[model samples]
Target: MTIATLPAYPPKPRPGDRVAVVSPSAGLPEVFPRPYELGLERLRRDFGVEVVEYPTTRKMAAPEERARDLNAAFGDPSVKAVISSIGGDDQITVLPYLDRELIRAHPKPFFGMSDNTNLLAYLWSTGIVGYHGGAVMTEFGRPGAMHPLTEASLRAALFTHGEHELRPADTYRDVDRDWADPAAFAGEPPMEPGSGWTWRNADRVAEGVSWGGNVEILSWLLMADREIAPDPSVYDGCVLFLETSEDMPSALDVFGILRAMGERGLLQRFSALLWGRPKAWSLESPNSAQEKVRYANDQRAAVLRAVEAYVPSIPVVLDVDFGHTDPQLVIPYGGRIRVDGPAGRVTVTY
Candidate 1:
């Protein structure tokens, strides 16, 4: 979309403001109360925001019920912001039930990622910018203390306005512990030294409004013909950011999705691209550290392959700390992003 037609950035919430916790995706909090409670405590203690939960915040209710809670949260003037407990696989099912007119009338800063990309994309279509990180169960309720980088980025996204620079994390963790086990909450997850960000075609600077989210979710959205504009050029001059979930789809799958987007004439419209670090390990696929590195390399290669086919010269930064990786940074959907390849810096206007 052109700058004149870009979505409006919702007002940021203050520390004392009340924020709604809803389950637009999955009610993971019900299955894992310890982490959910911990996340709530941190939201109140660390962030100083009062927590207001909806009916389906902890229960795996029907799609309409989840959508009702979402509408209630946004329609309630007392709620200044809304956050998801966690993301799930079938958030796309919840979209048809949402009251877009209600949400558009009462816009609130919404925070989530993964399956919540459905909501982020919905909000974007409704002319409101939504955050793509800071899910309660994962980031806010992180085992032990929250990651400093994550907290800083979340804080800026929640309370401040204007530009916020994003820095590469020196360390990150992808291996997840069993949230069902109390031991998992005993301390922070183990992390390894990070290789920093990989920049491609970064010889110049590019700035534009940002778009995109979890790659898998975007593919689903495309398949469903959901929130994406019919005109591929709506994303022209936009900064596209994408990440993978814990499902760990093969590199072939990643390339296939991007190839489809390129075939649709959607991939070439962006001025820059930011790829979130892929989660190389999961419970089902507990890859070795070496295997993790190889998986990441393959994923990166798949992305580069697609980039070569479309928008090859655009600035591309990979392995950004977002999505399923530990210490995730909040990326503002439908907000301003400046990608400076020559300066080796990336900044997002919160």
Candidate 2:
């Protein structure tokens, strides 16, 4: 999708604009109100934007309800933007019930990540550029305080229009703290110093529209054939950005999914890739410090193997902060991405 053909990025909302916060996926807000409330508080105090919640924002409701909230939020002139309370696994279910024509007529900036990727991809296909970052419970309500990088990225996406250069976090944390414990909100999570971005085939530059989201989520979309363009050439000059979730699918599993895309002649369509830092630790798969390091290293290798198999010459940047990791960047769905290997810079047009 070229800039001309890609959806027009919806207008950025003003500081006093009312923004809708809905749960288009699982209602973790139902169980974990601490983070959700803190997130909403920040939306008002920090962002100076009024927050609006729907029936399903903090409740486990039907997909139909979630879609209706989205319609109402976008259809209302007072509501300038909409964001998710958090992402969930069943956002794909809500997609079927969404009215594309209604949404197409009332395009508003939508911010989210993880399984909200379903909605981002859906919005992209329907001719709207969605923000692939800023889930309320996660990024905004990060314990202690939000990361400066995350705040800057979110603000630029919400308030400005221009090309922004993406940078690797000086430090990052992939581990999670139990939200159920009030103590968890008392301090920031541990952070490890970053080694910076790893680049391959870094002799040239590639510029195109950015595509792809959570790697595992993309596998789901591929299987469902929901919003992915059928023609290979549709992504001919795209920059594919992908990341994994806290589930931390095995290195082999990672390769298998990318390999499937490779076999379908999909892997080679992009001129470059922005591979996000893999989330290596979760409550269920808690690993030793050494194991976490090894997990990230192994997944990086798996990603390289798949890319090497089909697109060895394309520039690939690894460890970009755009997925489940802390201090994440807001990537523009169906927006321009410039990967300049020689300059060692990745600039995104928002």
Query: Of the candidates shown, which would achieve the greatest lDDT relative to the real structure?
Result: 1
Lowest-sum lDDT 10-residue window in model 2? 1-10
User: Global lDDT of each model?
Assistant: 0.93, 0.90
What's the TM-score of every candidate structure? 0.98, 0.97
Task: Give the CA lDDT, 0 to 100, for residue 338 in model 2.
Answer: 95
Q: How well is each residue in 184-214 modelled by candidate 2, as lDDT tens digits? A: 9998888989879999989999999888998
lDDT by residue (130-154, candidate 1, tens digit) is 9999999999999988999999999
Q: Which segments of model 2 are wrong by more than 4 Å?
A: 1-4
User: In model 1, what lDDT does residue 205 have?
Assistant: 97
Clashes of each: 1, 0
Q: Report the C-alpha displacement of residue 217, candidate 2, in angstroms.
A: 1.2
